[model samples]
Target: MTQAAAYSAARRKLHWGWITPPVLFAAIIAGATIGETRIPVATVLQVLGNNLLGTDYAVGRIDAGIVWDYRVSRAVVAACCGAGLALSGVVLQALLRNALADPYLLGISAGASTGAVAVTVAGVGAGVISLSVGAFAGATLSFLLVAALARAAGGGMGVRGAGVIVLAGIAGSQLFNALTAFVIAKSANAEQARGIMFWLMGNLSGVRWDDVWLAVPAAALGLGACLWHVRSLDAFTFGAGSAASLGVPVRRVQIVLIGLAALVTAAMVSMVGSIGFVGLVVPHAMRFVVGVRHARLVPASALAGAVFLIVSDILSRVLVPGQVLPIGVITALVGAPAFALILVRGRAR
Candidate 1:
């Protein structure tokens, strides 16, 4: 094909890429309508429209409350968490140039969990900092530690350095996980320990609209920040030396992108504990659908991740009927096999 025609065809494909987001939105709506009470789709729509658009449409007060107050908020939180985590994965994979890189893989989740556990179990920062703030601080500290260790091991900018970073991350994760466990074991009452355990396992139940406000904005901002660095990410895929030669300010961009990824991971984990697999698997899945270009991959991954988690959250609710499973459990069950398949395929290749 001629260059212009090929460009046109690619643009057309990109336009078709728009379909995923709408489908995800539809899935979110469908998920919101499902629960123990089983709100109808039409009632859910009416409630959402009346609240969001100031429409005159009416629904049963209980149904409206369930849809508008409970289910919608939970779904939004799930979507935001999923999108943020997946976007974090995309950025980290590009920054580290490692297909296996994920938000949790780098100790961010462990750090967040540690910080949260410290607050909940030990009350270390109870008066001074909230759990969410503590989690963010811990996540930031973990990323800094990993970066510093990787740099010390041998500058964290190339393939060798990526390996060092991964090793450092594993060490950091283990350390934080140990700290979290110690805090829970030593200080927490049985009830507190159970709550901590449940949070660690990743429950989205009882999330309020307040959480929606915190999570959605953070996720949106993080995604915007990552998208802003798309050119830099693209440049880095060729190596730090190549990116620098292309005027990408390789180290600065890497730090900024990684920090953004950490921020997204911290935000989500703070609200809902460390849910796994969305970050690890969603990016790869979206890459298969949208190709490897960061511009397409980032947004597509965000939408797909949102959809994946929303559906997973619904399954978590309905799986046992009247009892909710931890959303993280569901994701791990799905993601582990998906990851294994990816590994097997890679080996075959």
Candidate 2:
């Protein structure tokens, strides 16, 4: 492709990647409201319109108030969580210079899960608010631990040194996982253990709209901060030394960018369960379409991530008979093959 043509392609991919997600998210939410009944798309919109503005339109009617209520909230939760994870992926990959690194690789999700479980099993009111808050606290604490540990192991290398981060993240995540398991196993309540297990697997069902509003500002703050660092991220592609030579404050930018990314990620994980792989896959796929420039890549990844989990969550509804699956499982089932394909293709190139 010509230089102009390549840039045009990148911009087009970014536009399509961004647009396609919201449209797909809307479709999934609409289709899933019917559950196994599979209502038409127009009907879904009509019901949505009715709920929001009372336009007296009906393509279909679900008799269960609880079902639709749970579904709408779940859909919103999944979309926001997916977007957060994708942006975290972009930020972490840029900051660490490791395509293999993910938001959870640093143990943020594990820490959040541990905190949520502690609240759940400690006879604290298992309300959504309590669990979310506890989980957020855990995630932030985990980020600090990782930063401290990574800094101690720095060996005078720049923050973007891939080898140190990969080792540090693996160790940190394993530590938190062990703690989470202990909490679950030691709890005397079977139901609570099962509930904690399910929560760790990730589910967006049964979320309240009020919880949605509480998380909105955090999400915006995280995403906006990442966008502001897009220029630094692009400079990062050339490696820490090169970016420094170009006058980029490499370490300072890494701390700021990754810190913001982790904060948003922790908030999302607190609200939703520890959904995985969205971060690892979505950014990689978007990169294929829109080079490695963070300006285009970050927004495109966010949109793609939103669509991906929404569709995955909807599939979890129908993938089995007379039951629903954790939305996380569906993403792994679907994203694994797609992620593999991307990796294989990249190697072939």
Clashing pairs in 1: none
TM-score of candidate 2 relative to the true fold: 0.85
**Model 2, C-alpha of 90: deviation from truth (Å):** 0.6
* Clash pairs for candidate 2: none
TM-score on alpha carbons, each prediction: 0.92, 0.85
Assess each prediction's global lDDT (C-alpha) against the native: 0.84, 0.75
* lDDT, residue 206, candidate 2: 52
User: Against the hidden true structure, what lDDT does model 1 obtain?
Assistant: 0.84
Query: How well is each residue in 1-349 modelled by candidate 2, as lDDT tens digits?
Result: 5999779857765776678656855655653565666655565666667787778864434532433566666677677778888888888887777887787787778778777777767544556558667877777777778767878886234555567777777888888888888877887478877776776788776566876785667656767887777778888887788889989998899878776776777677767778888888999999998788777787788777877877887788888968889878988887789889999999998
Tens digits of per-residue lDDT for model 1, 1-349: 6999679757855774678667866987977888777878888888889998999896878888888888899998999998899999988888788887887888999998888777766888657888787888889888888778888888555667778878988988888889999999999889988887888978899688999989989888977887788778888788778888999887788777787787778878888898988889998877767788787787788887888889999999988988999999999999999988877876786
Query: So what's the TM-score on candidate 1?
Result: 0.92
Q: How far in Å is the alpha carbon of 151 misplaced in model 2? A: 3.6
User: Candidate 2: global Cα-lDDT?
Assistant: 0.75
